[model samples]
Target: MNMDLTHVLDVAQLTDVGKKRDHNEDSVASDVSSGLLVLADGMGGYQAGEVASKMAVLTIMAEMKERLAGSSSGKIDVASGMQMESTLLRDAVAKANAGIYHASRTQPQCAGMGTTLVVALFTNDRVLVGHVGDSRMYRLRGDAFCQITLDHSLLQEQIRAGLITPEQARFSNHRNLVTRALGVDSVVELELHEHDVEAGDIYLMCSDGLSDLVEDDDIYLALRTLNANLTFAARHLVEMANDNGGYDNISVILARPRQPYSAGRHWRHRILGWLK
Candidate 1:
């Protein structure tokens, strides 16, 4: 059975140029009807970063929407054994990477341009998240707040190797150095994972602009205090980043499922209805 999340999910998003940057290079998009949310943080010269980020967000969203129109999210793929929604998101990210990589090679101004991408698709009472680079997704359930996506950055690699403590890595000069990003190469690998969603769970997708400046504890408090109002929670997060010297473009997407979105109808029930 397919579930419609249009009314089940509450979503809010915001982006800012930030205190230091002359122009914003981050892009964000959300479709409540499709239960899709995407965020990209661009890195490049002049307006090239902005172009790359916008291209990624638009391309991914368009690809997913077109494919989803004809298929059920709960269907399983024979080859990968993953659900249709997960495969769709993976393919969409690949398409977006190809488009951006092609443009970077063909356009002189866009040379060396790339963007970090994070996307979430909510279906069957679960969220399938795909990401590249340092852009991230976080989840807040009950009193626990934790990061959902692991960054593809130098700092993260160091932490994994035990070269630096997570606390020390936070103060490292190489925090902005991402080891992997879309458009930087001909092919980019997207890390995808699935998480169960519960009612009252708040998911945050944001650029490093917010994560780099605000501490995790502060973010948790803000979300816990303002979960009732997602709009205010999103705004407060961006404001906190700016207050801490927003050195980069800031973007955020906050989504909450107000109630359980169980997949409609069991197989036996459907069979009975057909007989009736």
Candidate 2:
């Protein structure tokens, strides 16, 4: 996690309050210095959602920076058997959950508050993604764009059980009905995924606001058209979501991996792929 940020990855981020919401309840952060990225979508009344989302983002960023500091890299988490980067990302999210949960329990305004989280960490040649609730991560490789993180939502479950189809679920009223969320309970289970990084790979982490309103094809189109201008890509995504009703807070973080300087880096990735 402590790699030099010298032309390693291209990163851009954007967030919007949306037309329907009076205040933005989503938070996003990208720290190329620490090779960390995060996004959170919050739900609650009395502005607790905003508080929860901000708290989640700040806590996770701080924890990740601290944990990835020095040369620890990371160690295998016994329960999950994941590599160091994965374990560290898991621990960072867990730490954020603890902080948010503690505040919700003690603060009257924060009672029953929670947020959905999606975090990604970049290492030398891999990406570790961890998420809770419906916040998602998608990877666009060449002409292919597909979601990488499975959602923990009732709608997703119904689709998996064949009770509903993807098209049906899309228009279903359960778009915001997440089955799992941070700070909702004392403990939460996170979904973790890993992928080998390749040059020109584009990763998108976003809240449900964009996914619920904008079609996947549209997202792909924006990224494909504005791939070179990440700033425009991020803005266009939020703009597209708003045009489609923008029923909730919108947030996005885009990252593209860069080629390594040393030829040995390619060999290293090949070795990692072989191990996988």
Candidate 3:
């Protein structure tokens, strides 16, 4: 696809303090130029929660921006499609993890504080999704909205083990106990997924706030019917979460793939149609 004619991105972000939380601890950033959307949820017992999240968002994106600034977008011949796109996303996640861990060690108050990270990178007709911790990425296609990344949490493990039903785990005390996070260790394992994009597709990268307060079915239903407007989806998702008894900070970053008809392509098609 030509860079000019390929699907470009339109992004919207929204955050909330929720019904119980005094301050929002989640952070979201979108780089329309690079087609990058990142969301981080901080975990800490005290004020460090906000601190960790702030550091996480700033460090991760700063590193990613620096890397992209010097990037060559790879060769057009060998690297194309999902393979090249996924590699770029993986490298950025790795860099973010390393940066978070380094800050944890260097900063005193930041110790024992970590964050869940979810990133979505759009390249051509594919979206590369990567995550560490309970944060998530979702894609809406046609009439269905499905989670693209798996959650890294004890509750999820129990559900997988069949030790607890998903309904039971929804209210389980272990729901907040994340098994993986960006700054919790020197190395973090990331779950990566790639999906084919459609012209009307919508992508959501969100913190745990939405998942914790709102039900999965509700979220899916909302996204399934959500307008193509990215801002509408972002704002309404947070509002619904707040109304449903939000006890935590909520941050949502939304990006939609936009397919534009090029004048040349349109005229060519019209001419061909008339000739036929």
Candidate 4:
């Protein structure tokens, strides 16, 4: 199955610090060769958070480029593209953690700073996701949507153990507290997930700033309402969160998957696919 991807891939991203916060401490990076899109929301004392977030993004991207570029791993057959991507993504995150830890040790100002990471890697027929902390990845398929990754957070742990009801966790004082993140220690734990991808599927990578304030249903509506224009959708989505009471820094990335085959097919067929 040599699935050809759309020649033109479009991605949209937007970030805003809520009304209460002055600075947006989240950062995003896209590595097309490995098909990775990373989002990190930093948390720590004072300005250390922003420093950690920036370092995490840069470190991951740099490591990925260093490892994948001019390396034998990327020289594999097209048939093994999926496996190559998987390995690269895993290695990149580990390298990022190491770099963040090293930086924390070298700089007293950023010592102990940490950040949550959510990364999505797209392949010909699927998308692979890796995450730690509370940032999230979402997929929209046809008329339905689902969260393809889990949150490694204190609130989620409590909810899972039945120690706190979902409602309580939503408004809990410890809701923003995360259980896992990079740069806090020498090593970090990560979660990786995968899903079948299709043309017309829409993907969203965001931090807790957006997810905490905006509900899933609202996201679905926004995508439908925006007609999938990159700039319009990204800005409006951020604006929605800001209007809803900007409590924290908001970040968003919206991407729509297109099929190579569809480009040469009958225009009406493509239109009918949506109607169906």
Candidate 5:
């Protein structure tokens, strides 16, 4: 994708151990220059969860960065109607999964460690969201807030099969029992979705720790109140989750579009203008 046609991103991220968790098992990474955001929520024994989450984030970031360096040509390759950006996003996730899975198998300490993942890559006119397990991506366009990624958990399957209602699934014991996760096996499937982005649109990528405890309406209110300040909005979301009996580690990433990329504009000036 042509960098000149894309929107500059304003990003803020925060992670917390939460009120009840003894250790944080979540990891987050953001590459503002490339408009990349990643979040992972891990599960395992002792410190393995933290290790797995970090590995997933680092692997994805490094792989994506390396591949994106060659994509400056701004040529969009199409395959079965999927854009080049989408293909790149998919390949990046697959590469991360391979690295994580290999480590889990070879390292005894990392045995059984797996993590939920959510990744957002912003191109010139669209954002590609790729996810596995239950970590999510939400978008706030104007006054409307909606979840853009679906969870790959048993509760979600049950809800889809009409075995339970949305209200019942909320209180279900299988909320955290994800049917898909990275590093759990040699390969994993990721659900990818694309959305057109606007200059005023705000995207939120978070772990289940925050979503499990906080109501969507409350989260929307928080975003609406502090949308103008990404840092404050991110910190407030973590605080709110802890206040509402944070039963797990919480992580949040906020990204907002600042301005469309213009070749004639100096990059430094544009960044300074957004910070102002």
Candidate 6:
């Protein structure tokens, strides 16, 4: 069954060039009806970063929307044993990567362009999240707020290897050095995961600009304090990042599940209405 997320989820997104950057290299796209949201942070020469990011967001959004419209979400992939939604999201990212990489190689001005991506597809009472590079996704449930996606960056690897603590990594000069990114290579792996959705759960997808400058504690406070107003919360987050020096382009997508959404619910509601 196809479910419309317009009423099921409350979503808002915002992007800023920040104080240090003359041009914004970040991009965001969403289809509330389709429950798809994507954010990208690009890196390269001149305006190539902006181009790469826009390409990534557009490609993934278009590809996923078309594929999902023709396919069944519950169908399981024989090779991966994952749901169709998961497979579709992965393939969509791969297609975006290929398109970006080809453009970077064929177009001189776009040479060396690459982008970090984070995407979320909400359906059947769950959210399928996929990402590459250092862009991230965070979830806030109750008083607990945490990062859902791990950054594929040098600092993250250092912290994982015990070479540096989380606190030290925060101050490390290698924070912007991502180990993986789309368009950087011919083939990029998209990390995918599925999470059960709960009412009142808020998910934040953002570029490093916000995460790097805004402390996690501060983010938690902002999100919790303004959970009732996503638009304000989103703008406030961007403002906080800029207030902290805004060293990079900041982008954020805030999504809150207003109610449990299941494909079967549509049919059930129709049947009950007809009987009544």
Worst 10 residues of 1 by lDDT: 261-270
lDDT of 3 by residue, 1-276 (tens): 213222356788998888898777788887776667788898775766676677767766776666655544422325444454455566666766677678678878767778888887665456667888989888777778788887898888888999999889887877888899877788888788767778778788888899888877787777776765678878889999889888788988877767633335545767999999
**On a 0 to 100 scale, what is the lDDT of residue 211 in model 5?**
94
The lDDT-based order of candidates, best leading, equals 6, 1, 2, 5, 4, 3
Would you estimate the TM-scores of all the predictions?
0.95, 0.91, 0.84, 0.84, 0.90, 0.98
Best prediction by TM-score: 6
lDDT of all the models against the reference?
Answer: 0.91, 0.86, 0.75, 0.76, 0.85, 0.93
* lDDT tens per residue, model 5, 157-226: 9989999998998898889999999989888998988788888789999999899988999999999989
Q: Candidate 4, residues 1-276: lDDT per residue as tens digits?
A: 112233535677777777998787899887553455789999876778888888888977786666555444323446545456566777777877887788778888877888999887666456778899999988777778888777888889988999998778878888788889988777787787677767788888989878888878898888777746866977877888888887889998876766623223434556799999
**Candidate 3: deviation at residue 9, Å?**
1.9
Which window of ten consecutive residues has the lowest lDDT sum in model 6? 1-10
lDDT of 6 at 34: 88
How much does each candidate deviate from the true structure in C-alpha RMSD? 2.5, 4.7, 4.5, 6.1, 4.1, 0.9
Better structure of 5 and 6 per lDDT: 6
Question: Which residue pairs does candidate 1 place in steric collision?
Answer: none
Give the runs in model 6 whose Cα sits over 4 Å from its true position. none
Candidate 3, residue 228: the lDDT equals 59
The TM-score of predicted model 5 comes to: 0.90
Pairs that collide in candidate 2 are: none
TM-score for predicted model 4 compared with the true structure = 0.84
Alpha carbon lDDT at 267, candidate 1? 45
Error of 5 at 81 (Å): 4.8
